[model samples]
Target: MIALSRKHRTALAMIGFLCLMTGSGCDYRKEFQFSGPTMGTTYHITIKAPFWNSMTSLDRSIREELAAVNKSMSVYDKESEISRFNAIEDTRQSMEISERFAEVLSLSKQVWDLTEGAFDPTVFPLVRIWGFYTGNENGLPDEKTLEAIHHQVGFGYVRFDDRNHIGKCIPEISLDLGAIAKGYGVDQIAAVIRKAGYTDFLVEIGGEVVASGRKASDQPWRIGINYPDPAAPLDLVYKSLTLQNKAIATSGDYRNFRQIGGKRYAHIIDPRTGSPIDNGVVSVSVIADTCALADGLATGLMVMGHEKGIALVEGLPGTECLYLVKNAEGALQEFASSGFGKTP
Candidate 1:
């Protein structure tokens, strides 16, 4: 989940009740809530059912589904499909991949094209250069070093044959699916819940969320967007929306960042610049049909800034975005796409 500062946590607590309210009256539909750790964070799943059996079975199924996803995409796992592929040095041979991996790669390519390469997954080397990969905040790299590594990064270096589920990449190029994998995992868990005949549900991984059907109270699932102020408490909610059968993902520069000298470097690096973005836009929230798309787009919009991000979202169908920008005078300015404020 997006880590918030102490002040932001307090703000979040203040607004928590407004975002989700359980039905106080007795109802036939019972609510089940459970959570566990996954993907270096945690996941929360809530379901409303008229009749159910064995929470143990349900939890086991959910964990198994999520574990499969992690085994496919996690960079930290040396035995993961992606990590194993990264270890290969031959660019001439095409490698077979799991269906899930192929699906994510295809979607990532679409996002790469849509955002004009602002959302490339092949920039992991740049991430490492900035010390984001190891959590060590080293100073910036020299121009020559950046240029040399720049040759090794680019989505164009990757080729995917969807018909055969095969992937090919230049020897030096590798992928990091950190941005979209968690959201995809959330969607997969939501699928598991729906398959079990439960439609009224909410699945959240870290901060990425997907809401299905409605609450037992017949109210739409409500989600709160955190304020884009690092100094604010995590409980501080800038806006709240009711959504059903949709997914929401947010990307912000406030939480994950490194401070060097008088300047701060956000975790999100601009693939185009081969460096961390210093754009005025502080946070981006995207609502889409799938959490994976929302997660990828949110990161893309943050790199694109306000004007182009708004334009890109407006042209797309079944999508909306909210942009929070820190202005010159330190005031936060809000901008939303045409459909962002509409009732779902």
Candidate 2:
């Protein structure tokens, strides 16, 4: 489901996230650039190096590989394998799904189970009902209407068999991959890049960013975290860290929701309630070994809110999160996992 960001009267903003050039102390710099189309969105890559020039051919390979990934995963595309399966579930005795597709759904189930229905694919029905997937160009839904959608949302309904690459949809149920598919696709593309002997690189899909290696400039890449305020320049550097074999993802409901009836509602919905989240969190950023984990987990955190989400992140090794939310005083409060604050 696509998120619908709510605009509030309060002047608080935490906006966009960017993957930047890698290096150290603003001096070291590397020249690595790779950008190609996939997933109905262009993927941009920047790598620093002699390695960059050495692997120029890799740019084309990376793009081509990611395109293949999109074919199997995109629920939005009617011709996509997943989309076709969604359309034809009852017509055939069995539904054919791809190995990669099965893997993503399988991983999604894990998050669904771990979070106890927080990150659910079955919430697609609720998403469609609210018109986030279609009709209503405007954002936010009436509370009574959204709460009714809660009946159709559940993660346990999506059934798949990885061994045979088959998936079946329960009646009246739809699947939404807006939260995790992009990251999973990025991970697949990254795997292809590393397999082809490219080491130092960065990859971004619709603002989900991951990078590795140092820039020729010798400084860690500086990522600019946007403040939602339109008037404010993106001067605040939220992080200066090397991707250096790590993946990072940031998820926020602020970017996509709309204001309604003087209340602020997040595009991120609570599957159990089938309503837009009221979790005061502005954004949740995650760091992990793979973009897939970081991506799915970020969505999970969005659906989980602050306290429960932080508890979840704290218990997972190598998983750190920074949550931005409105405090009791209405001033912004930043809560970071132990692994996050040390970034230069």
Candidate 3:
């Protein structure tokens, strides 16, 4: 996945809402819109509700739900549940986790198994060694250091008992849930909106998004797919598609990376190799039933490369992907799954 710093994640697309005034033949509803900082990035929510008095209550509820998620999974929080688990060194001791943390872990395991371990949460050590976790760039680690740390990285080492809500790290592995947490946050906020009796809404955190029902204009939410061009001054939309009751996420290396000795190292690390991925794939966009699933799959597909990633998306249900790769002729080539809307 595209690496997001503690400050913010590179927004995948520019979001906008369309509003129409009330007229004789037009149907107009008051659109409640609000944005605020959360989870190291900004969150924007739009809801179509008949009553305008509930805005204050809805906003408070949204903030509280997001804070609850951060407390459960944020590594930057020293006292967070995941951080406390990382501090433990004993392999035999099991730690009890909250239901939210357990849910994220369970979803992560399913993607890990689906991608054959391509989407791994235990790659925090590798992320630090590559200087992604830290702002200071450390060129590259030696062969011995790489091999030793790689031995300690693997999702299989982390064991979880779903029935009892218990988790244990077999080899003292640290987890960086940067790739999947934002998506989970989006899902949580959507749930809060739905529970409050709002059926038409859009919830976006970082770049991951989940849309339900239609906008105030009675049109499906329109989302843009950004072109994966590093030379572009700003994000350029390659195509736009309508989405409802689903989630969309994009992972790309064009924006986040470090350069050393004429070699560029992307923020995304391949768990199987213990290094930054240099594959030709520049970006991957995934659409799924939930933002969390789309977010994890986008990163896993980026590591799997173009052909294999396309094949994997084809076999999965309720999922589609678009891959942008640089060919030998120095041109961008696009490969998309059968279900991915009109290809550009």
Candidate 4:
């Protein structure tokens, strides 16, 4: 597996990719396994039967799409499309972008509006200043530094046109897709798999998981919600959830963290405050109808904490979250909403 640290912080991943052989009821079978990088983490997807033969196509094309996404969205990358937009009079403001851009921008706006600017993409300056980005790590910025970037933050400062497929920023502001792009990638691959005429498979791009249909054994999709701990072994998973025709995404402050000057800092940043939200929560797992919704909710709930986050999920038309909070004794606690009761 290709291991990459998160702004939130991270560890090695031991993922399994399994494909069933075809015989009688299924005449052919194949299995290909590899660790694919995503969401600043490494993930493995096992395509079975017909797809095993086309593993190269899936790997090459998926990596390219992810690269394109990073180029267009990662604020840490200077030459990326989003970075370039914040560079200056980005003249290509009205030009057509890839389909992924359109979908992501729309989702970004929705979450930003819904959260009342809590989920802004333009908070990169603040994020970077607080050491959540590439430059700093577990180092708190002075008030002056925080103030300097605060003005450059806020989703309201960014502008885009969906009909014309264009985007623009205040030049000083940047976009970070750390919260949403992986789900979009999963959605893209799901669309691709559907196009490929595969009916039974599971696609998880960096924990933004989407399970299309049942396995050949008529079993529901099984997903594990990890127990977060930076000081312990990563492969030691403490929980697992099963789903069929569902999306499971987890946002936590566990893996991605830094300790400097005896202070522990997680990578999950609060856009409004330019710091991490120390909700007693370890991780937030959400199950929803759409991967995009689950991804956004996971991020939002991670910041909103347990009480408000659970309230938000309860009020939503169809959304569910399991809040894994850490107690004073360094133990994990669980909280779920009525919406979670509907999840299977």
Candidate 5:
């Protein structure tokens, strides 16, 4: 069974209640908004079109697109494409996947290479061993266990082809797209909106967001980076930016972490170190042309820490990052790329 976090439930109660009352089609100042639960979270979409042929059909299409992505990548679903691939115990067996699955896996490989093994989809074993997957801390693993699990974690152990066939070199190797799948889901939802003859829109899944065109009022879509505090209100923003035809994704350990023996361990495990990131960095938000890229980069940056993360993001064209770090004095510090917040 899929277990929902308190944060997840709170998010659903906050947005799901409104969408439930509005029936997935709410009209506000010539903008139409719709939302629903998917991928263990909720998605909110706003279209600037003054009119559409059928709001119901458009809403259904958005949900269908999300379901398709969930069917392909959801690790919580035992029958999902990724889950089924994980169940394969023989190295000789290769699974033929859908085009969508291939696209996401390709992107995962790209991110893994870019981050120098920081953003690994094969870190599922580490995540589970660290207790973030089951939400039950079984005490920190011993050095021997960590070493064995770390050996199993790397994208290089997995093989994929241009024909959309994927296989693991060892049966113990598994994949998890939790870091990047939501952003891909956002992009897919945006495609559905665009296909339905809408241009100006905003699509948000979990915390990943994609903004296209401008609002009906002719203003750019404004998104706020939340303060990296578990106790902070959802609206407590550290910074806000106006985005037009861009995507932004934020990765932070503030909300998802386990405290072991008075020390906090983040959910984001470093595939390289085989441990939760203890770097002073608290949050990383990345902006790119696609939410998937932003999402993957954000998580990779978190594992890369502040200086290297900023340096890497600055070198990449058409990409920007903002990092929030905790200082030695226990204060929050902000580090951002030169082009960050210049979006308009």
Candidate 6:
């Protein structure tokens, strides 16, 4: 339920357009950029290809890929596959879903289990009750109200099978893929670019990014993690990584929060406690082989806090995390996995 300011959206939309229109070309390769709005945010893509490669066809294919993802996953779309399923009221009946929908759901389940319910798409009810969802009143709910809603929140209520049929055990249970869909969109577009025989490209949706091969300058792609300081400039970099053939997704509480009763509540809710996360951990960034995994894990890690988060990541091969936490004295501190800043 995090809201993006109009200013942030406009800045993202302009970045790729300016890069593409200016014809920023090097001696051996030309970098082509494409950008537009999607999934409640903007996406920017840059491809380093030979001078002869046609951006026209690639642009068409990339847009098609994004459209397909939005059609399947966007909750805002009343006619989307997810919305249609959410409309169903019968627990005994199951609806057949597209393969792409099943793919994202399967990944969601894995992250849900791995994080021990730290991340649950079924937490939509709690999100609504906390007034994080649009059109809801923002206030602390009574204990009775919180208890009633907790009964409706759990991934166990979601029923699905290998045949791509999905149903909820209760009519009130619903799914929201906001935490992971953008990363999945990035992965899908990266696949599209690879299918077009392009080896060097970077795909970014919102702040989730995936890098493939080196840039036209023969250097690894440099990605900056946003500094989780509300007072600082929006594009300020806390850390930079040179990435190749990897994905990074960051989730932070600094930007998305509601001030109520003279205290701030983060948009991220703990499905287990049926409450907004108030832990001092302010930001989490995950690096993984796939952006979808990174995206889900980032949110889950934020809920897990620092100690357990670091321990959980240490066991996950090819997965690393960086956590920015606030000490009791109100100072920013950093905790990272063993291989967090290492070049992959």
**Per-residue accuracy of model 2 over 1-344 as CA lDDT, tens digit each:** 11223542121122211122332223222576666666667777776543213554666677676767777768767788777766754623467667777778888888888788888877877766665646576755667777666655676655666564554555545677768888887787778767765566677887677776655565565554555432345454444445556788888765666566786656677788777777677778888878888888988888888889889888987778888787666677788887774553
lDDT of 5: 0.89
Best by TM-score: 6
lDDT of 6 by residue, 161-219 (tens): 99999998999888999999999999999999998888899999999999999888888
Can you write out model 5's per-residue Cα lDDT over 1-344, one digit (the tens) per residue? Answer: 22457876676566657977878844432688898898888889988863423478889888788889999999889999999999999999999999889999999989998999999989989988898868675898889988998888888989999999999898899988989999999999998888877888999999899999989888889999999999999889889899999999999999989987998899999999899999988899999999999999999999999889889988898899999999888899999999999844
Residue pair clashes in candidate 5: none
Number of the candidate with higher lDDT, 3 or 6: 6
Q: After superposition, how far is residue 337 of candidate 3 from its true place, in Å?
A: 0.4
Q: How much is the lDDT of residue 228 in candidate 3?
A: 76
lDDT of 1 at 269: 89
* Off by more than 4 A, model 2: 1-30, 51-56, 89-92, 133-148, 228-242
Give me the candidate number with maximum lDDT. 6
State each model's CA lDDT, in order. Answer: 0.87, 0.69, 0.84, 0.69, 0.89, 0.91
TM-score of each: 0.89, 0.81, 0.89, 0.81, 0.90, 0.91
Runs of candidate 5 with Cα error greater than 4 angstroms are 1-29
TM-score of 5: 0.90
Compared with the true structure, the alpha-carbon lDDT of candidate 4 equals 0.69
Question: Higher-lDDT candidate among 1 and 4?
Answer: 1
Question: TM-score of the candidate numbered 1?
Answer: 0.89
Off by over 4 Å in 6: 1-26, 135-138
lDDT of 1 by residue, 1-344 (tens): 22457876676554555455753444546678889999999999999874323467778899999999999999999999899888878777677889899889988988999999999998889888887858765688889999999889998988778563444567888888988899899989998998777789999999999999999888889999998878889979999999889999999989878888888888888999998998888899999999999999999999999899999999989999999998888888999999996885
